[model samples]
Target: MLSEVTATRYVTPLREGGSLPGIVEADDLGTYVMKFTGAGQGRKTLVAEVICGELGRRLGLRVPELVTMQLDPVIGLSEPDQEVQELLKASGGLNLGMDYLPGSLGFDAKAYQVSSAEAGRVVWFDALINNVDRSWRNPNLLVWGGELWLIDHGATMIWHHNWPTAQVSAAKAYNASDHALAPFGPDIASAAAALAPLVTEELLTEVAAEVPDEWLVDEPGYATTDELRRAYVEPLLARAATIHERITLDAPAEDKPSQAPGWLSERLAPRPRATKNDKDGGQ
Candidate 1:
């Protein structure tokens, strides 16, 4: 379980996220961005946040510290919005909180640069988690203290939504064609070589244990919470070994950028199939 804190105040809702998480002051005198279990996406979103955020942190990636927040419904009484009040009331118990990084700016490729080595680690981690939200349109990355930090992992590991086919979903290829880091020429091969061996069953088990039992209870097909936790571990362990091989960064023509190095730009550029006439020595 994560470090626990009690919410002392609800400051305001962060409208940027679809799930409507809010800023809160906790009893520990720390400010955090709290995600409500009562949100439409439900507890599973927080579950994913804990597992992925913690896993990323353990892998030497920068991730905000996470804590389990205990919320009291009365705190929302001061809020005027009916929707927000209801949401707070419904989420009266445990929720998720991420330490707020003050004054952090959203990542902008034009203003900041990422080394190919760093970019490869990020892209490879995203692939391992099967993240669909790290595309250029919504990078979900922040630049804090002049370093990159990963956040908002609620949308990763989509296979959990359908347990019966989780293995099948985990085995599918990851298309990084629209990935925010595609232009940086991520060295996927090197990343896989360095990180794959570290993603052991032991580490994954530790990560899974961070997810509270409340979230795993009553999962449709699983009889026990431990069973549900194991379900998450198996797929990720399998994906880590080979996901880099299937990564595709063939960006669409419209999204292609001219800033990449010649080698990377050529690799990311879509190629046309050679016609028979052209193949025959330009006959």
Candidate 2:
């Protein structure tokens, strides 16, 4: 399991995220962003966060360090917001904590550009996880210390919500046309070449072990938490075997800046080179 720490204080909620995660100070003298197990999305959200976030870190993508935070209900007593207090009370046990990076900025595709290699790896990973939240409208990427970091993985692994058909769901083609990185020219083949071989059974087992046992208990079909952990591993490994081949960026040619719909063409238009005659005339 990831390092476990106890929350000492809840500072404020991050209004931007759908789950209303908050900034917290932990007893270890570190600050973290807390994802509550009691969010409307349920413990399944945190489960995805741990599984996907840890997997990305292992795959050499930048993801914040994670921990299993011990949240005490009493920490909410000082908060005036009734909703926040209720949520804290309900999430009194284990929750998810991401190491807080101070002064980080949200990703802006317009202002910044990532290399095709980086874009491909991220898009490929998102496809395998079935994350639909990385669209241009709400890119869940962060720029901290000049490198991109992935966060907000709660929306991935939708099949877990319907356990009976998870296998079938895992085989479907991913829709990444609107992915924020789509316009950046993702090199999916290279991503598969580099990361696919690393997703071994041993790696999956280690990743699954990081999920807290409490979240795995009483899952509808599983008799024990270990059984549930194995369930998480099977679908992902199966998806990884075939998903890379099916991930066609699918973004139209016009989406690329050089061929964009209207003004983009003008912005990318090539300027004529100055001739020798023109240079001599100026001289």
Candidate 3:
């Protein structure tokens, strides 16, 4: 369990985040981004942050540390001054703090032009988990300490609910022509081979264990932590090698700018786009 801290100081909101994460100094002298889970999307986002973020770390990817936080209600729903209160109300629960990446830039594939092998590994991992967040426009990658760190996995495994029938197939089929597509080949194959063994039932169970019970309760499709783990986490780990092989062989090698889809990119981007009516000269 994460420790509780009194909210004495307020950290500024991050311009890019949807949940409006704030920077705060914990009682333990650690700095973190306090993220409030607002209405509608609060619990799910937290679960994704914890489960996927932890799993990625286990798989040897760099992800920021996360901790549970409590926002002071007295602040009560204001921006800049009452920002913490507003965050608490919007999130529907207490606030969460993400470990801030000091002086780190968001992920830019162009910055990393690594070997096809490394790209292949990243692609395979993304594909295996059906990660739709890492796209051309808003690649949720960060550069810190001269390495690429993956972030914001709240959108992965959506296909599970969105496309229930879809399953890992022997046929490797994914759109690899995107500019951000990882270079695929034997290097990816070798990397997959090395990483395949790391994905196991125990690993999945451990990852699932980290998910809060609030996320697992009263859901018809996914009831109980173990069931959710079996349904979602287990399949990906089981098919890790196959999925990796498929993504490596099937994806195209191209260099493209990071741009997410229309709605998604709008949410993830540092700046919002003008509405169509605004563009059309509406008052």
Candidate 4:
């Protein structure tokens, strides 16, 4: 289970996203980015965030640590933003909090060249979860401490929105043509070989079981939260088995020709070590 904490104050909303996630100060004296249950996407979005974000963490990818935050509706009284006030009041109890990474710059492929291994690993992870939001325009990736971090997994597992028709085949073909690092030609085969074996039934079961019971309640066709947890795991385990083949079969041609690669090779070719100032890329 994730660490549980009490949210002591509601700071300000991060308006960059549709769900209106906000920066919150908690009793633990740590700042967190809280994803509200009352947002338009609803509790279901938070469900995906926990499952996929934690799964990625266990798979050795960089993701912000997640915690179960206890929110009090009374805090709404002090908020001037009516929209935020209503969201807080509605999401009175348990919500999801991702540890806030301060001074992190949004990932820009042009600004920083990602190695093939890193790109491949990320692409592989995204494909397994059926995430469709890593396009070049809105990468949903952050760079902190000169390392990449994945975030905003609420958009993954869209099939869960309609439980009746959802199938293991939810792991459909992924079109990576517009992905932020598509030009790098990720080593999907190598990544799949290393990561696929790690996605065992036990791992998915543990990850799915971590969702707060409050968020899992009232889910249609399930009488208990345990059943809902199983529903989340089954499709994901099925996808893990076939992700590599699906992506390799569906991947389109790259922008640059096969012979000459662009920015990545030039940036990676042996040269003087990058200075700390250079790492910021002038954010």
Candidate 5:
């Protein structure tokens, strides 16, 4: 279970996304980026964050610490934003909170160079979870302490939205052409050899358990939260075995044929070591 903290102060809204997640100070004196149950995406978004974020951590990926925040609607009474106030009023209990990374820079690919091995691992992990949000336009990645940290996993596991066809969706191929790490010539073969065996039933079961019961309560078609959890674990376990083969890294047709080959080859070509001051291209 995630550590729990009561929100002491709502600092400000991060208007970057539609969910309207905000920065808040907790009673434990820690700062977190809190995502609300009342946000348009609802508790399911929080569930995805926990499952994918924690799983990524266990798989040796860097992700900010996550906690369950106990929010009191009254904290928003002083807020001038009517929408935020209403959101708080509606989300008066448990919400998801990620430890705030101070002085983090958004990832900028053009400036920072990612090695093929690192890019392969990230692309493989994203494929396993069926994350559709980690695209070039909105990378949802940050650079803090000279490391890449993944965030905003609420867009993962789209099949969870419709249980009936989830199995079919789970079997579908992952199109990595638009993935943020695709340009780096991800070594999918190497990544699969290293990571696929790690995505076991036991591992996924443990990951699913990290999701708060409150978020899983009364999910349709499942009599209990544990049962609903199995629904999440099964697909991932099956997908992990063969997702590498299904990953399509082909460049999109919009790119001119001549330019696409040159661009990909250039990015993949061996280059001099990148300097520490080089830019990271993810925001």
Candidate 6:
């Protein structure tokens, strides 16, 4: 879908993003936040976003629309002079874009002042997906148009490799008492139920088709496009309910006050029996 474009213009870089996302203008004149695979992290990151973000949207979470764009290498790297081009070249040869949320400020839980019920739903969803990006220090929530918007899904489903055999504790550290854990259990269960039926072969093929070949060309592990689709996209959709139920059952209770109001730790706390080396890999 992104290949139909002829050109794109790179704008400014988003300083807050760890991956150095850039703001860019697409051929249609829409602005998006684009993350690059410059150093080889692009394919995985972009694939994760497409699969998970789409699934999240289906589950009724507020995620911005994601689309792939063919970066005009020259436009992205172009600067006032050749000096700027060299600088851009060293950064990355292509760019990605996220739909821009105008006039939005970085999310602060206190700003939304969401009820504990709302917070619970957010917590449950994060836990279900094993999202490790929304901790107190780096709560990647945004407030635009008077609502909460979740962003940066690069850290979800990190345990997809052994998901069938993996323990819940291996994925996230959810407990019943965590304030962000309870409100959404019922809703999450319902959402998962609805999502399960939608993960059909056609849907899987269609969405996987949306992923750019440039992103997957060299990833040996995903040898074929079908393998890539099944490995990365289909499971999440097919097992939506199972995964949802598992996370809801294991999610921390909502009795404890949120340590930082709007933020919840994306990483589970370490177990006493965990080896020193087992510390917080998901975070």
lDDT (tens digit, per residue) of candidate 3 on 30-83 = 788776666345566666677677777888877787677666654454444555
Global lDDT scores for all candidate models: 0.90, 0.87, 0.61, 0.86, 0.89, 0.58
lDDT of 2 by residue, 70-152 (tens): 99899999899998999999998999999999999999876677888998899999998899898877889999998999999
| Model 6 collision count | 12
> For residues 1-283, what per-residue lDDT tens digits would candidate 6 score against the true structure?
5433323676676767766677778787788877666623445777667666665675567888876666545674445555334434644444445688999887654444565545555665676556777764577778888887878887776754444543443434543333232322235544445555665666656656666666656555557666666665544443444555554233343553344322243223344686556677645
How should the candidates be ordered by TM-score, best one leading? 5, 1, 2, 4, 3, 6
TM-score: the better of candidates 2 and 6: 2
**Which residue pairs clash within candidate 2?**
none
TM for every model, in the order presented, reads 0.90, 0.90, 0.73, 0.87, 0.90, 0.68
lDDT of 4 at 268: 50
At residue 103, what lDDT does model 6 achieve?
Answer: 94
- Deviation in Å, model 2, residue 217 alpha carbon: 0.6
- Per-residue alpha-carbon lDDT of model 5 for 1-283, expressed as tens digits? 7899999999999999779999999999999999999999989999999999999999999999999999999999999999999999999999999999999988877656678898889999999999999888788999999888999999999999999999999999988877777767788889899999999999999999999898998888999999999999999999999999998877545553212123555654689876655645332
Q: Give the winner by TM-score: 2 or 3.
A: 2
TM-score of predicted model 3?
A: 0.73
The residue-by-residue lDDT of candidate 1 on 1-283, one tens digit each, is: 6999999999999988998999999999999999999999999889899999999999999999999999999999989999899999999999999999999999877666888899899999999999999877788989999999999999999999998999899999998877887778888899999899999999999999999898889999999999999999999999999999998877346445422223345554689999998889887
Which residue runs does candidate 3 get wrong by more than 4 Å? 1-8, 76-85, 92-95, 110-112, 160-173, 179-186, 248-283
Model 6 regions more than 4 Å off: 1-7, 76-95, 115-121, 160-206, 237-239, 248-283
Cα deviation of 221 in candidate 4 (Å)? 1.6
